[model samples]
Target: MAFQSIKHFALELDGPDDIVYSSGEMVTGVVILELTREIKVRSLRVLGRGVAIAHWLENRSVGVNTVYNDYTSKTIYFRKRQHLIRDNGDLTVIPAGRHEYPFSFQLPEETLVTSFEGKHGSIRYWVKVKLHRPWATVKKIKKEFTVIEPIDINTPSLLAPQAGTKDKMARIWYRNCGQVSITAKIDRKGYTPGEVIPVFAEFDNSTSRSVVPKAYITQTQTFIARGTMKQKRAVVATLCGDIVGPRRRETWHGRAIKIPPVGPSILQCRIIKVEYMLRVCVDVPGTSKLSLELPLVMGTIPLHPFGSRTSSVSSQYSVNMEWLRMAIPEQPEPPPDYSSVVTEEEAAQNSTAVQPEEDLSGVLQPSLLAYIQEFRSRPPPVYSEVDPNPQPITMRRRCMTC
Candidate 1:
């Protein structure tokens, strides 16, 4: 038999969760090589590689009337290799037995820390082991791993829950209607996977038209290339909606939207940026829809004191009542008063009739000016209206018999 000695080849990680890792952490694993009998090997090598690749297809106009499909691809990567056994001068022979070679590598400190797999692109990390032979294709084994960075939620701004409400009047479009207002609030603005987001909403449809409010969370990614920027948004999750009666208002409280396992916000990456937002909108037929948006921060860790509670029983409880405060109705601004503002016609008439400055010999006298200046320089007035000035009081008592 040509290849009777080589029995088995495998790779195993030291950690229990072999696929999970953090930046700058040491990764240790073992390469197992089992042989049926004595065998000769040239060398054994291990390599680690991290790469981000983006590829897509689009249609392009070729000539005056012809169109063609084109494909585009871009990649950024890093690779490290180490030799466990090198064939310096002579080949090494091993007796028939189970052999294990341990290897370790330290990931770069300042590197892309999150692993992402998406439809159009991917950020991947893997470790590969190869057994080199003279003139034969090298036998290889590869394993994928996930890398994540710590996103602390203890920051003062992130610790507080986020809520906002907006109201708008549709008089320009819906002239016969009054106003339509939508208020939406979330328990907190920052969250991680496995955490539930509590959403509370209220809608007031003062217009004559019926309104249906819809709310959803959208994840947007911005890709920058060659001085050009492109953006793509995908709906990650959705909340329930309610139909509001015409000229009526309704309130909804404590609707939970679970966050799925998705990549966190990627602000550290230069070419790629990820952001999430909560959008609340009302669909109005034959008119423009009213909508409100709130920025959401997706981190690697959920709010502290409650971590990884997706399977916990207490997560089913309603969020604090404070989250509902965002549903407060919008107050209309006071209408402008024409009396305080001079109109164009009135200004023109006054300008035409106004005379030159009149002589004020009596009012602008030296004595009068001096008196006014003296009065102005004097301290503020002090009145004896309370304790210093006493008022006479009369007291009367009713007898118990009466």
Candidate 2:
């Protein structure tokens, strides 16, 4: 046979999960090879590359025939080439039963954007090995890895609370109808996966019909190429609130919503971007719904304890980031039992809002961890509700001034 000595060629990373490798860190791995006999090797090389590519075809109509136009764009973040083993004067043969060659490379410190993949386009980081020989064909193997640029949630802008107010009017037959208004706020603008977002909202309905209020978190991915753009949006999590009676008002006091497993925002990339939003909306009958949107930044590092941002930087580095990638619960929560519906007597008579308790914790969304292996051992996040402040009901007075 022409080639018989080469038995196995593979790359093995130091960590069990790819999520551990991030920017400004050395990605150390070993190249393993097995052979029955000694073989003369030209060179064994390793290549590390990070790139963002966007490609899609758009259908264009010309006269009667439709033509597909390809829209493609790519941005190269970095490229590194290194030699694991080369044919020097003395080192020519790789003797055999089983051999392991170690390699290490430090990722670029200049803002290496987090890795991401999408349908229209993808931003990826990978390591590949090429084996060259004088008498045999070249052999190659590649493996994708993750690079998470830690976005600390304790920053000034992300730590500040966010609030918004919006109102919409509904009309039937062009006649002037009542209006519905919503005011909503959250504790902060940034959070990692698995953390809870405290939602405080007030809904006032001046219309004749009862209105239902709902809230949901959404993720949006945008890819751009040569003045062309593609976008994908999805709802990540949803929660429903009690209805506001006609001409009545209802308020939500720190009612929290758990964030599902999702990737961090990719704002530094020029070719692609990942973003999130928290939307609170009211369903108005026979008319369009009025909604309020608050921008959110999903991050790798979680918020500081006790809702304080002063020590965020110090605290972020204190925790082991390895556990964060698989920290969240991706399982769908079981349906809640409605048997414990609260009665008027059981509800709080006070309307004042109280401070939310501290939660001691962050997950990789499916898309982010799809390539990473053997990391699903952790249990899902515990579901906790910061009971919303009860709305007090006052009885109507029937005294008439005669």
Candidate 3:
């Protein structure tokens, strides 16, 4: 109804149905403009850009007085434009017919933050087309694309396994009430989404009260704005309530927690960060929770083949220059905070298989493995509260068909 002269404006990518790309890959697409009637236009252009945005409200209390403050930040990583009709003179008329404009762009080789849609933030790449007319308001169209950076588990740091042990003594005044100790280890520190993380836990509880042990995977996202940093955390997956009776020593040889297809670790990204932690928690009545956390790195690809990887540093200068050319007057914004990077339905299908292994059998006999396996397969424990803060508004993109 807004524009009678235009029929349908469609954008199509030259790839499979899913519009996904890796770092340094070329993105080629076409903008099809079907017009019902002849129209006049000043120029036509296509723009490609990537941006990270974070916005949230913080609450604080001071001496019975409560106050709320709003915080917002945005960062533009790259912005590039290609004019399809730059040289054409003024008042150019596009005849009524099917018209197609082809466009191509190469993503920077430097490691880019993975595409994510979070509760308070987002890292997104999009292609936009504009039909500029002197007699009418500008008509624009936008399409979103996904970008993933390859993560190799075969890297030396990730290849070496990780382990840690901790001991905590509960004290009341000067008297020791109880002591709890745990040893935890993982097969690998780096993993891809859908891989099962086997956590081997040994608990020694020397106390009067019973301790409930729980294991879960946590996702932490840190956003940096200017110099200040804000973080949001969520327990994406979990297994809990395996009782460790008083004065008992229990060993869990195989507790598998599947990694959802979420964004990989984003340490190199300046504004946004995505990191996972395998947590072992023991809840004690009338006492602080005792826990151990181990870092987990997620990537798009696993390092089975151990192929050589290309250097992203080669395009660092070009990326900086591109940012300068965009000339955004405001400060750069940090990446977004994701709420559910992987949907529940999607997560169910992409879980790691609970396969029996001979190597694991050596550590703990079939009895212990079966016990832990049954516990792990049970439904995940319910979380009383994910976060206390108000839910952030979910972002909605303008219709790409418009």
Candidate 4:
């Protein structure tokens, strides 16, 4: 009779315990076994096992009191079985008590990384020892471990500043680490009207963790439209808003904040050429408030000579004066004079009277007169010329008579 008892079991492995090892690595361990009586073992084996498991739950509620729920689970397993060898070329026997055996097995290199987040799968693995005998029961012992995958980070490139602007600014952030960089563009001099300027924001992530970021940016501009005597100024508007995240639903607040006019001297020039300045400001979490000023120049549409020369040089100034207000006042323009305006029906009738009628008389005159004259002049065949006998002469008879 043969009996076996587990004496000692110890597992030794390198690398992260929760991280799956690359397949090239060797899993080594020792198992000590004792025999109550003299035992004969036909074969001794060791097994290494890896398993991936995932679980999910979903619950939904609708209307006043309706509820729906679901639960799901998935699992995958990998197993390797190897025979344990002894130094000697003979069948090894456990005489009694303490006996130790060392074993090593190779794991598959193509195994996917297991994750505890349940995104990929909950990775679980185990190493086990087993003994096989021809006439005896198999004995087994097992131990378990896990693995984690790495994260990827990315950042954007820096951009140059616009022309004619003073306080040029740039933004950058990390895609994975949530790190942000707000850089002032030293090169951007200013902006011109109708010139689309591109502002860049960059992101970088050098760490192993992934992060999500929310950003808000706004730029305000004030420029003078050169006018004679007094220059008029107003805010040239540009609005932009965007959301950056691992996913799209995140919303960011952004606007070109129009700064209040500092002084009347800022818009004092009078010519087709005008000078102006722009201010840029940004608000973000974990960073100080950012603000900068940039200078710009623009060309304006010249005022009509006679139009600006009207009676009260100041009386005709309402339009130009209103144009000088930078905030873009919300007051509505005066309503149109409806007293002189005609209704749709009346307008349609007036349009009809203004159009000339078709001249069918010239087209029909000659054709009609000719048709009538031809019909009246056609003579009726005379009935008085009727003959009692009709002559019929043969060609041979006519030739003989001649």
* TM-score top scorer: 2
Say which prediction, candidate 1 or candidate 3, comes out ahead on lDDT: 3
Q: Which ten residues in a row have the lowest lDDT in candidate 4?
A: 383-392
TM-score of each: 0.66, 0.75, 0.71, 0.31
Clashing pairs in 2: none
Error of 1 at 353 (Å): 65
Can you tell me which runs of candidate 3 are displaced by over 4 Å? 58-70, 87-89, 171-174, 303-402
- Supply the global lDDT for candidate 2: 0.66
Backbone clash total for model 3 is 10
Candidate 1 vs candidate 4: the lDDT winner is: 1
TM-score for model 3? 0.71
lDDT of 4 by residue, 1-402 (tens): 444344443444443332233334567666676666556666777778765433333346686775644333334446787777433445566676767677777766553342221121234567877776656677777766433111110101111233221111222452233332232222233222222222222322222332332121111111111111211222223222343333122221111222221110112211111234443333323323333344432211111233332222122223332333432334322211111122233334444222222222211122222222222232221100000000000000001111
In the range 1-402, model 2's lDDT, one tens digit per residue, is: 536777777898776543445567787889999998888888899999999887877687999999998889989988888888865754477776899989888888787877665656777888899988886788999988866666777788998778899988867777757998999888778887767676778899998988888777766567787786665545566667797888999987655577765667889988777788888887666566677889999876665555674332223223333433333245644322111121122223211212221211111244333321122222121111112210000111111111
Best candidate per lDDT, number? 2
How far does residue 157 in candidate 4 sit from its true spot (Å)? 13
Q: Which residue pairs in model 3 clash with each other?
A: 74-333, 75-333, 118-337, 118-338, 118-339, 119-338, 119-339, 121-336, 121-337, 122-336
The number of clashing residue pairs in each candidate reads: 0, 0, 10, 25
Cα RMSD, each candidate: 28.1, 16.0, 16.3, 44.3
